[model samples]
Target: MGTKTALITGANSGLGLATAKALAQRSFDLVLLCRSDQKGREAQADVQKANPAVTVDYFIADLADLDSVREAAGQITAKYPQLDVLINNAGYTPARLEFVDGIEKSFYASHIGHFVLTNHLLGSLKAAGAGANGPARVISLSSAAYLGGRAARFFRKIDDLSPTFAYCDDKLANLLFARELARQTAGQGVVSYSVHPGAVRTRFGADTPGFLGKVFSLAGPLMRTPEKGAQTSVFLASAPMKSIGERNNGGYFADSAPKNTHNRDINDEKAAWLWEKTMPFV
Candidate 1:
């Protein structure tokens, strides 16, 4: 059989990089997607140095831009006949409101971009699973913050520009997408999961200049390291199908275990609404 392949967004730093390295150690070929060419090259070198026997390549695509995402997906699909795992780990939480395709920046980058990219690569994922040793998986990095309230409270509309609301909305969307994906791809040999990597000492929300930034800064010492934060993602990507539990196909996981989400209202209606509303943007 061919070597397993995993594609990771935001692989240049933080949990994304840590997950890539862990997968490399497992002998999976990697495709690191970064927004910056310089950082992408640096991360590529780091992964290569850590695992010289595995193939490590980097591609540039800013997740905030749908066009960039499509271009990158095109390139990826053209080059790789199959994709074993896709870890949507990139996210954004700006201090002030930002817009992309008229949608909130955090929502666009964290959820919308990955939504489109995953659809574009679904064929590859299915092909991989069909020919691989086991089912292929898609792991999305959501946040425990999503449990604060119902996503509809913050994400009633796609145009909501509040930074905090947008961040929460996207995290909730991540879980919704994963759940819906699993539902749609059932019996297709592809499974999906949304993961909360725990509060990790990463650059998340550090760019924000206000109370949120200060909170992330103060919480730094108390949070998990990037390596520890990546454990759930690596587990979801590499663990046995039975080990992860068939019931977890569309579930949320943290610390390598299934965790309950706060949004009890996340049902087929909400997922379908989100998918339809965000279709034009993608």
Candidate 2:
């Protein structure tokens, strides 16, 4: 196979780092988009330490910040003509209410940034699809917390952004974005998938306050380790595109398997609606 490149956001730690390491093992040259130089460098060294043969590189980009995302995306596309995998795996639970251009910070971090970044990199992804790989994959990390966000509640009541509610909405948005992206790129040799990595014990919410923080502290044994949580994402990225496509070009997965979601709210209408609303932000 020709050189395969994968770009991952929020790759400093948690599921993102686990996924990066796993992909590195698969011989993928990595480009990790992180928010800090120190963290990015540390992650770069960590991945290289684990897989010396693979080329591991890192760039700084905050998922909630537009300029940073654009600059990183440009660098990625310029560096690689073929980007085989893109895992939109960075998610944050806002410690407090915040917004970027009126969009809730949590929502921006989870969905909008990925949205813009994906759109910007579509050229490279499609280029890879047209190569020997022939079906470039975009795997986005969403949560089953989407179950908490019903269609009726999404993208409404914009002003009062509750951290919890924002989390739910963004995950819902991730699923919807994956579906819509698959729809848009159906015949272009590009496929997108949304993943629920299960409840993994990671430092993502280590700073969360109150009951949620207590849950993180006390639920260590109950949650899967980051490596264990990364199985589905790794599976989706490495699986034969034909098999994956047969199941669903844009499917939701969990437990390392493609799942058929019964949530009525997870529909094309909602997906398109989200895609429409997201255009302006980018």
Candidate 3:
């Protein structure tokens, strides 16, 4: 087959950048989606410097804005006829409640924005999967934090508006989104996987309030580095289809292995419901 192409969101920093580097080493042409043009260019330069033979391009899009997501997806689909992989790695965790387009900022950017982008590019992904040796992969970056919310009974309802619960709900939405995408596209050669990158030492929660921000910064020394955290994403992206197996097609994984997600509420029904409710925002 021809060379593969992978698009990664938030590819300028942290786990996204790490995954881009790993894919570049494997010779996959990369399209990086970054919010900042300068950072995107710098990241493109860095990846090209590391792998001179690989192709690296960047597209700027702010996930919090649905119009930006739509425009970016349009440009991507117009430019690339085939897309082998998409990693929804960009995330936001605000210290306080903030809304964008009538939805919570973190929830909107992390899950809804990605949901729209994936749907827009579904045609390209399917086309690539049809002609390639394996199915196209959609990897969503969820978190173990969803488990904590489940323990606290936060996911009992799908319409919680609390800022404190925004991040957890968003992660759960990511898992459900991936699973539902897999189910809806079954037998069509598009595969979706949600993953927990495991407490990476990246600047994820730096924007949160005093105690929370301090906690995120203090835990940096004890957490996994971005490279280590990107392992599971890279693994899911590059692994052979037969090796991954049908059982893991819509499953959540961590540390390069399929793992059980904590929330029992993340079924097809909830996934469908969330998708319907969030559609207007996209």
RMSD of each: 2.1, 1.8, 2.8
Candidate 2 lDDT by residue in tens digits, 230-252: 99998888877665656577889
Q: Taking the tens digit of each residue's C-alpha lDDT, what string does model 3 give over 67-157?
A: 9999999999999978999999998886777666556677778887899999999989999889844589999999887764432332233
Give all TM-scores, in the order shown.
0.94, 0.94, 0.92
Relative to the true structure, how large is the alpha-carbon lDDT of every model? 0.85, 0.85, 0.84
Which of 1 and 3 is the better model by TM-score? 1
Clashes of 2: 0
Candidate 2 residues lying further than 4 Å off, grouped into runs, are 151-160
Task: Point out the worst 10-residue segment of candidate 2 by lDDT.
Answer: 148-157
Residue-by-residue lDDT tens digits, candidate 1, 71-153: 99999999987899999999888678766555567777888889999988888999888974658899999988776435564
